[model samples]
Target: MREVAIIGAGMTKFGRSDLSLIEIMSEAAIRALEDAALGDQKVDSVYVANMGAARLNRQTAIASALVDQLNLFPAMAEAVENGPASGASAFKNGFQAIASGMADVVLVTGGERMREVNNLEATDFVASMSHPQAEYIYGVTLPALAGMFTRLYMDRYGVTAKHLALVAIKNHANALKNPYAHIHQAITIEGILTAPEAVVNNPYIADPLRLYDCCPVSDGAAALVLTTREIAEKLGKPIVKVGGIGQATDTHAVHERPDPTELTAVKIAAQKAFQMAGIGPQDIDVAELHDAFTILEIAESEEAGFFPKGEGHNALEQGVTSLGGKLPINPSGGLKAKGHPVGATGVAQLVELTWQLRGAAGDRQVEGAKNAFACNFGGFGNNVVTTVLMREE
Candidate 1:
């Protein structure tokens, strides 16, 4: 297989958007193409990643629409959906096309305009990813699952609400440096968890998970221009190689997992990615874990091998994961603060890493970052896609 590298990356600001799904995606794609400086080069294929446009926007054939919108009529166009991991799944498909000698230049874009519907409807649309007979029928929202998971993790690992609040505080502070992050408001532990008005300020969404613990439902888009190594070098852009990509799945129902507290899919997928990248978690300079909920960041960090099985919060408390620390996680604010546009999240994570590797991330940049990793979690813990990226010397 030929080596693949990313030449350009771009993303629309995350938050509620007035633009249509295709328009937002096209805007991101154009930004990426311009960043790549492809000039006269032709794109061989285009992949659009999205979870719910048909239900929310009442639109279909989004990939074809994006092609026409971008004036890339003859390029191969396809839509990919894998619950919340749709972005990474589409990226994997694009990577395969280039590696298999089927395409030289590929455009992978992920976008979701989830704000078109009401909050309850959007929640239900996302909940459709759950198992019909086991989860969805029981009205199991993601937060409920995360709440239960957090409770179990706390009991098993000594993580407390304070630890979870710390996660929120850290990520919120980081997001202040990110211009594209969805939530710009600064939060303090006292304000959210301990202050007299805390109960009303950060009300509990689920038993253990509060409003601040959840990622906001957002509308946004992100895009990447990927090509062969030769093409990347010729373009005179920083060569961010797609070092390794790994994916794994578990039981569809959260109750079916052998150990509910263990994110088995994240562990297996991260191991596969590390193995393929010829490195271990220790070698990762920065990482972007799936932080849809505050607990997820801690849980995924441990599962991804960044910390011991029950010690992720300890690492957080020690400042190991803070920016400018030993290893910064989520320098782009993460889903906790960056916004979780389900379809756009995975791709957005890569875009942030690409910027960090290129030394272009303004204030949130992790200095001297060479190797970066990302884990895009889907359907509770059932599906996941992990990626490793290296800045070529």
Candidate 2:
């Protein structure tokens, strides 16, 4: 079709916000709109992504509320819900709107006010995305699923708890440099894993996956202003093009998968995205995988072709995924420390990549980075949205 470019990206600090969901999203929208400086141009439409405002916040019609609150009268407004991948799903919709010649400019915003509910309620709400009869009826939460996956992956690949701890330590250190990151507390290996009080400190939520291994329950919002290349030229900023978008799905039940350790959807989605971008995993300078759990970063890296099968943790051990490594992964602190507001996370990945390409990521910047990739995993790999973005100087 046509080329689409992100002109601006903005996100609120990902933490417990007392702001209403609409207010949070609108704030981010206004910031992104200002960043784009779309002087006389009108916003053709708005797509809001969220997962639990209806159930947790007792609200609905979030997109309508956002557009109205921002005073974007008469613009088309629609809400998208695709579990945790909701952000990328909504972003894909915006890309289609611009690329198909339907809209000149689209505002894509994803948000969640998850802190409105207690931790137990939040976990249950996210668990609702699982298969109703097969998973939810049996009370399967995401952490328990991830824990099981981690154990199986370890058995197959020889990954250990120490490697998992290394992931947490690295991401937490990265988060200290990110002002927008939710968890600013620096965690040491001794404190979390090696200390005598480690059990009390990093207690296991599920076997082999402790509290520190999990992303926190957070509330936040992120937004992007996307337009065609022609519009981007007038915006007078460096252009970060949406090179390719790919999405895929797998079996709904974790037990039904042919190989429990393999993330087939991640592999398929990454392949489609790379083919569309006309690049392979080797071409990516930086990446942000859906590290809601530390093991996911390692698993997704392998499935996304960044490493040989069952060798992702080896790369981690070699420092290949660190900030100054050959290919930096999750330089934005990832969902591990940056926080996973479910709906907000996918868009936040794009926001971080846009900043990295623009040379504005500050302390977490990947020097000379040009091509970046993001994978937003949803519902234990049942659904995934992968994106490849390129900077055109």
Candidate-wise lDDT, in order: 0.94, 0.94
In candidate 1, which residue pairs clash?
none
lDDT of 1 by residue, 153-248 (tens): 999999999999999999999999998899998999999999999999999999899999999999999999999999888878789999999999
**RMSD of each candidate relative to the true structure:** 0.7, 0.7
Off by over 4 Å in 2: none
User: Model 1 misses residue 351 by how many Å?
Assistant: 0.2
Model 2 C-alpha lDDT versus the unseen true structure = 0.94
lDDT of 1: 0.94
Kindly give the stretch of ten consecutive residues in candidate 2 with the minimal lDDT sum.
230-239
Q: Could you tell me how far off, in angstroms, the CA of residue 318 lies in candidate 2 after the best superposition?
A: 1.1
Write the residue-wise lDDT of candidate 2 on 56-132 in tens digits: 99999999999989999888989999999999999999999999999999999999999999999999998998889
Clashing pairs in 2: none
